[model samples]
Target: MNRGIPVRLPIGRGGGGISTIIIIAVLFIGARALGIDPMEILTGSPTTTTTSRTERTAANDEAMQFVSVVLAETEDVWNGVFQAAGVQYQEPRMVVFSGQVQSACGFASAASGPFYCPGDKQVYIDLDFFDELANRFGASGDFAQAYVIAHEVGHHVQNLTGVLPKFNQARQRMNQADANAMSVRVELQADCYAGVWANHTDQKGLLEAGDLDEALNAAFQIGDDTLQKRSQGYVVPESFNHGTSAQRKRWFLKGYQSGDEDSCDTFSGDI
Candidate 1:
C-alpha cells in the first residue's frame, strides 16, 4: 500500500451485463458539467417539449465508442478500488444525445452541457461539446474529450458510493450562493477523479503529453472566470460555482499526483 494517499493498485476489463440501467442523480455544477438536468425531469417535471427520435449516426456511434472505451477505463480502475474496499462497482451507461433528448432526469437541450443524472445512474452528454473542446477551448485532443467523459463517470462513482445523494440533499437546503459553492466542490472533486483516471491510464500507456494539457486547457477555458468574462463581461466571485483556473489546475494535478480516490475529499477541505 502506498501510504500518504498515492496508492498504486494493480491495473485491470469491463463487464457486460443485462442489468437494468436507470438515470439516478444529475448535478448542475459547471458549464462543462451541464449537459443534462435529471432531477427536475425525473422527479415529476413533465417534458414540455417532444420530437421524433433523432437517429444515431455513424459519427455519433463512433463518438459513443470512444466514450465507452474511456468509461471502461474508469470502471476498471474503480472496480479494483471497490473490491479492495469490499464493495461492488455499479456500472453506468453514457447516453450520447444530439440537439435535444429525453432523459430520466428531464428534457435537456445541448446548451445544458454534459451532466450525470443519478436518477437513472447514467450520463448524458451532447457530442457537440466536442466542438466546444476543439473549436472553442482549443483543447483539440481526443484524450481531452476522454477526460470529460471520465469526469462525468466520476459522478456515477460518487452516486454508487453514496456521496452524491448526500450532497444533493444538502444542496436542497442551501441558498443559491451556498448551493453554487457546494457545486464548485463537487466539480473540483470530479476533476480530481478525472485526473486519477488519467494517471492510471497513463500508467497503462494511454495518456500522452498534449493530452493531459488538453484536459487542463479544457478545464481552464471553461472556468467561471473564462465563462463569465465571455458571457457577462465580468467575474463574480460570489456566483462562481466552479473554482478558478488555478484551482482547477491544482486539484487536477493533485489527483494525478496522488492517483488515489482517498485523496479526493474536496468537501471537507473548505474548497
Candidate 2:
C-alpha cells in the first residue's frame, strides 16, 4: 500500500458462486493496507530519514515465521501452476523490517505500508502496518494479513508474466489521471491473483471458517474510495488507483471462484 505518498505499490476480496467441498487440514501459514498505487520503478535520490528502531517482541518473531510459511506456500502454488504451463516460477524474497529500511526501490518507513519492489524483486513490509490495519482500519485476522502477502506475491507473478513490465512502459506516456486508471487495473489484477492463491489454499484444506471474510474485509477497508471517505470525508474517483471497494470485492470473488489466472485479466473489457 502507498499510504499517503506516491512512492511504491503495496499490495484483496471475496466469496460466493461456485461451491467446493473443503476439507480441514492442519498447516502453518502466515502473513495491508494503505491504498495501492501503480507499479513504478524508484527514481531520484534514495529516500532519507532518521530511523527509530523498536525492540522486537515474541509476537513479532511468531509473525515473522507466519510470513515465511505463507510465502513458501505461495511459492509452492505458483511453482505448480507455472510448471503445468511449462514455465518456471521465480519466487521473490520477503523483507520484514522495523521502522525504516532501504531497498533497491528506495528508502521506506513503516508508515509507507507494505510494497513489492520490482527493482529488487522483493516484497518489503513493516510488521507494524498489520497493527494499523487491524486497529486503525478495523480489518484483522491472520488470513487478512495473508491476503496482503498474497497480493504482493501476485505482483511478483505479474513481473514474471511480463504484465508489469508492459504496464510500466505504457504508463510513461499516460497523464496522471490516465495512469491512475490504468493502475487500478494493475492493482485489481493483483487482488484477483491473491484470490487465486486463496482458492488454492482452500483446496489444500487450509482455510478456516471466516477466513475468506477476513480477506474480503481487508480488501474493503483499504479500498481507495473507502480510505478517502474515512480520511478526507469524500472520494475523488479520478485519483483512485486501487479500484473501489465493490470492484475489489468483485474481482477477488471472480478469481476465487474460477481459480484460474486467466480469469484475472483485469486489463480487458470492463474490468
Q: Which candidate wins on TM-score? A: 2
lDDT of 1 by residue, 1-271 (tens): 0111000100011111111111011111211142333333322222111124435567654554455445555767787778889998886765666687666666777767777777777677676667665665555666667667777877778777777777777877899999888878887888888888878877766554566776776677767787778778999998987787777777777888898988888988565
Candidate 2 structure quality by residue, lDDT tens digits, 192-258: 9999999998897788788898888888888899989999999999999999988888888888899
Against the unseen true structure, what C-alpha lDDT does each candidate score? 0.63, 0.72
Alpha carbon deviation, residue 246, candidate 2 (Å): 0.6
Every model's Cα RMSD, please? 12.2, 9.0
Predict model 2's lDDT versus the native: 0.72
- Cα RMSD for predicted model 1: 12.2
Per-prediction TM-score: 0.78, 0.82
Candidate 2 Cα misplacement greater than 4 A, ranges: 1-54
Report the error of model 1 at residue 85, Å. 1.0
Output candidate 2 Cα RMSD: 9.0
Off by over 4 Å in 1: 1-58
lDDT of 1 at 53: 45
- Note the residue pairs that clash in candidate 2: 1-10, 30-66
On a 0 to 1 TM-score scale, where does candidate 2 land against the true structure?
A: 0.82
Q: Ten-residue segment with the worst summed lDDT in candidate 2?
A: 36-45
